[model samples]
Target: MDPILDDHLHLDPVKGRGVEAAEEFADHGGTHLLVLNKPSWHYDVAVEAGDDFRVAYDHTLDVVADSTEVLPGRAWPVLGVHPALVSQLVERGYDPEDARDLMCAGLDVAAEYVEEGRALALKSGRPHYDVSEAVWAASNEVMRHAFALGADLGCAVQLHAEGSEDFTEVADWAEEAGMARERVVKHYSTGGVVGPTPSVLADKDELERVVERDVPFMMETDFIDDPDRPGAVLGPKTVPRRTRWLREEGYDEALERAHVETPRLVYGIDTLGTLA
Candidate 1:
């Protein structure tokens, strides 16, 4: 069987089971994973500045190194500053411009990791709701900077944005940033948007829409690995199990498109090989 690729997950040590979660995913038939950096608090980037940004950036690289030790070729790292963290900084007395600068600096660090092949992609986007307009606009600037950096580094940028039926704004931002729309993955997608491929959660109903559209996209459990919430979005085993279910139900074409072809096309990852 071709390996199932999970496009979005978190291997946070403090809130999550970390390597244990990866092992569980493997046991369930998942072979490739894109693990995003843990939230900003893990490195205190929102509350501090200067060297703190470097420390926070380094922490994500450390996660990539450690996750590789556990999952080897199967685990790939995605580094970036989430928009929620940007909002947090703004609320904590950070000027919006400074916050944007901090996010850009973090993206620069992530770009280095990508250049070195220590990471596979960059993540940046604003939340769907709860952020002030000013904060959202500022966060968009941060995301634009990330898009440019990703373009320069030849890496894909996975976006975390508000749930919406239309993604015209995201596509516009990508264009304005001089990045290709194909390189921007809309994470946590509900399978509603038409343009700019998305990485959506595992849901049979949503999968129906995705298959109907025949769009380029991928599936993710968005597994947070939180011990307290324990599979808050979905369990580590969810994607593999869903892939099995889809295959059994004769959705082989859709399964292969999302689990294999699209990921390789978008992220330039070949999960069949071992990581160096």
Candidate 2:
């Protein structure tokens, strides 16, 4: 069976279905997942400083551990500070510069986890929504911090930013920071990304187009596993189900390139191979 990897996913055992969600993914033919840490607020962690981000990051690793107990090395944690946090700190009386410092510290903590091999990638991006110029500038600096960390650790950095397809500024930041362009992934990508690798959202039309491209790319559901949203971005089984659908539509070669070749090139995971 071809390895159906969901490049981005989230699971919560307390407020949402956790390991059971991973089982649902496995049930639908999914093989691996990059389980991302939910934003700080999700875990109600107080972000006074960088180390405070560890509360949420630690929770994410715990969730990955629980999932891996069953999946057995099929799941890995991706840790980082969410960019929207800058605004939240501002609203709560934190100076914008302080907020940026705090966010950078958070990424520092995340890099420590990556160095410890507790995570496979680092996650960071500016707010996907709009903010003031100061906040925006600060957030951009925080993004550079992540790119710099990616360069140092030689790990992937998942970005959750606001953009259609062209991430020219992001690309420039990564290049200036010395991070490999391919290791910078844009989560929830639609298609036609120019610089960073688009972990294309698991949508049929999007995949149909992206899979044909010669560029290295990936697929992700970005499932937050929030019961309240009940499939806000996409359902948990979207990736594997989409894979099966694409296969039936005679996209075997495309599947090989996207599912096996690109993942191998980006993540260095060897379990996935050419489509048989």
Best by TM-score: 2
Misplaced by over 4 Å in model 2 are 273-276
What TM-score does each of the candidates earn? 0.91, 0.95
| C-alpha lDDT of candidate 1 relative to the true structure | 0.78
Collision count of model 2: 0
Worst 10 residues of 2 by lDDT: 267-276
List the global CA lDDT of all models. 0.78, 0.84
**Quick one: best lDDT, which candidate?**
2
Residues 98-176, model 1: lDDT tens digits: 8888877777777887889878989888766787777777888888888888778878999888888688777877877
lDDT tens digits, residue span 92-174, model 2? 99989999999999999999999998888899998888788999899989999999999899888989999678997788889
